[model samples]
Target: MRALRRWWHDTAGDLPATFWYLWAGILINRAGAFAMLFLSLYLTEARGASEALAGAVVGAYGAGGAVGVLLGGVLADRWGRRATLLTAHLVTAGLMVALALSRHLLLIAVLSALVGVVHSMPSPAFVASIVDMVPEQRRSRAFNLQFWAFNLGMAVASLLAGVLAEASYLALFLVDAGATLATALVIAWKVPETLRRPARTPRGVPRIGSTARSARRPGLLTALTDRIFLTFVGLTFVLAVLTMQTSTIMPLAMRADGLEPSAYGLVVALGGALIVLGQLFVPRLIDRRRKGFVLATSTGLMAVGFGALAVADELAVYLGAAVIWTVGSMLAAPPNAQINADLAPPELRARYQSVFYLTFPAASFVAPTLGGVSLQYLGSAHWLVVGGLGLLAAVGHLLAGPARERRVAALLRGTRNGRPATSASGPMPAGGPEVATDPVRT
Candidate 1:
């Protein structure tokens, strides 16, 4: 018991107070995250919409989210993290209430998109805040703890959301709104603004007090133009697509093999269950390891797991595959996040994060479509294709390793010297040691 307690402390201790506040807010918000989870059912059962329309409405929400992240990233850099978070959360609460009361399908669709925009707007800011607060050496542990909180909240929501829906779909919206409001309140009360502001420059005169002109804050175009960062983003998207397979294609394949929906649910739940239980130890496992090797190993494990699905017909086989892929996911989460942070220049961090975040929603859309078509045409051979893609992505990470290491090293040196090295975004302002270093108990 003592050993376990010490291990837990080593893993989760020493983050800042504001980070804990953000962490708690995330947990509270996600615990009641029911609106998206059951939106299709709500539309079909309560509002009398067809399946195709429901799907389209959901697609609208995803499209809106894509726009939101980009907007949020710019706002995080411009308006400050706290303000952006507050705006997103408070507006999301209002939209949830509006969504609950609306009856018309078109109104619901429009509201869904609006809700998606406001709800997603905070993501880049939230992550940028973490990068701003946590020191580089301990960031892996901080991110892992954050990921665990998210999964834990999600696990709770999965159990409670169904019950709330059974009672009244309206309750789902109200509860979700209340949770969002609570998170907003938490941020308003506790979390401070984390966006680093540069010395003010006169309009059109370009009179800057600091010599760090890169601090002028570049737009999303900067992230788009960054070749190495774009390479990392592309690989992250591939991993996202591979990860989506467990939720999207795996279920269909299982059903085709005569398995029941309950069996699939149980199998799928295993992955989340594993994450919630074992993710805390992830930082210890990946600590000080080479980022490329860690990512390649993770992708390889997922490849083998998904590849095993080609022959999986029994419950036991499915569970074993779940274990392998879940471990891979656990391994990948922190390093992927840390690498994204490492690659981003501090001045353009939020924009870079926003770009990184685009992968999940993009994968959420593309994976199902591609996986569905491949399953239809390729049969079980689709798993072979998935394995091959996963391996290729793994190799990509390996080949990209040296260049990434050099980039991170240069950024670190610049940070220590109180100015960023000249790179794709040009000379970046000093970013290290800005946040207070006082350790806060978790």
Candidate 2:
């Protein structure tokens, strides 16, 4: 208990204002975003839409997310992180309000797509901001804390949505919109701009772009094309195939077993609770291990969790599967952000994260729809297929092998070299790019 208190105190010290701003946004957004989980139910029960039509609407949302993520990254790089975050929240807030007021299925579908785009807006910029504010050594822990905060928010939101949705569906939309607007206000007022001016080059030196900015240095595109990034994207795509099955198919399985909607919310809350608890300890426990090994182990456990779900019958057994899955997810979450941060040059951090996150939106675009179709066709037994795919993802991550592992390690080492080492850092070594510095202690 004493050690735990000490750790908490140390982690809290000197955190950047940007961290709090981002955290507020996540807490608000997640706490009210439970509407997405129950959207199918809302459409079916309230709008009298068929399951097939509802599922199509959900697919449209996922597709919009893919486009939003790509656009957010470009805008973050061109405009700034603060601008992207505020705009996304405002857009999403308005869409949520529109969704609450509308009854038309087509309009709801369009609004859902718009919301999806805004949903992805804060991602790349926020992630880049975290990397900028925190030191390399503390990044893993910082991301873990951020993940925990979000999950806690999700748990609360799920419970609130479950209770309120039982009374009124429109209430959920109103609450979600309000939270988003609150988050936007926080961002605009509190978060500092982390963007640094690029280093200047000598007059005689050939310039790469319009300005002699070091942050705009070439070779970023080359880094993006590296085999390491490709392998990571491939691995994430497979992971998405497995994870989306949980959101798309698991609820149907529970309903088939006669679980109440409230019980389903409880199940999700249990997972979020586990993530909150696990994030506080797992990073420390695995601190001495190779990140790849940690990733492999966590993904392997997820496969086991899904397998448990495949066979589970009793409510207790199902909840146990949730526990297992949550643990794996908690372990996996911090590394996801850290790996991207490690891979990026300081100048292109936002771009790198944007590109890295693209795999999720891209994979999501297909996985959920496919999983829904499979669930409709295969019934409850489809979970076994999902479990099998998770196992395959674990194997793929493992097979990325020593070469990929070394590349990531090298990048990590380069990041630790203080000044940026990538050619993308600047045109000249003397006046190379500087990473944004802030007081994010963790």
Clash statistics: count for each candidate: 0, 0
How does each model score on lDDT? 0.77, 0.71
TM-score of each: 0.82, 0.87
Point to the candidate with the largest lDDT: 1
- Summed over model 2, clashes come to 0
Candidate 1 clash pair list? none
Model 1 C-alpha RMSD vs. true structure (Å) is 6.6
* Candidate 2 RMSD computed on C-alpha atoms after optimal superposition onto the true structure: 6.0
Residue lDDT tens for model 1, 169-249: 899899999999999999999999987786665664332222133345347776776666677788888888888676556
What would the per-residue lDDT of candidate 2 be over residues 1-442, giving only the tens digit for each residue?
Answer: 9987888865555676668777877787788777777777787678997656777777777788888887887778778888898899998888998999999999999988888888887888888888878877778777877888889988998788778778899998899888888888888888877766567767556333221233344433644544456566667776665666555556666766877677778888888888766678877677777666677777877878877776776678888888887787887886767776775666666777777777766665566567667667876566777778778777766665344445455445554554344322222233212221110100
Clashing pairs in 2: none
